[model samples]
Target: GFKIGGAEVSRKHAGFIVNTGHATARDVLDLIAHVKRVVKAKLGVELETEIRVIGDL
Candidate 1:
């Protein structure tokens, strides 16, 4: 399985992210950030999150 700090992109669907146990909010956020950056750099497309992240990181 593929993962980063307990957060992983779903193998079945690329748009979903799964918590591989013991995952924190920071971990998921970091993973999302990484995916967005990579997609933007490689495809020249900016991804927008449907949910909002509140408070400080």
Candidate 2:
């Protein structure tokens, strides 16, 4: 678990995955969806992404 803006942001070990190299906006969006699904299924909490996804996927 890691902290961000006084909130516990993630549980699956932060800094494990990153958008360091050539990560487009769509790539980040996909990653966010995948993470939400995984956390929802495992933790039974519906996680809401803080960022707004614009445009089509």
Clashes of each: 0, 0
Looking at model 2, the pairs that clash are none
lDDT of each: 0.88, 0.59
Q: Which stretches of candidate 1 lie over 4 Å from their true place?
A: none
Model 2 CA deviation exceeding 4 Å by range:
1-17
TM-score per candidate, chains pooled: 0.88, 0.61
Compared with the true structure, what per-residue lDDT tens digits does model 1 show for residues 4-23?
A: 89899999998999998888
For candidate 2, write residues 1-57 as lDDT tens digits. 432223342456653445444656666666666667778999998876777767776
Clashing pairs in 1: none
TM-score of 2: 0.61
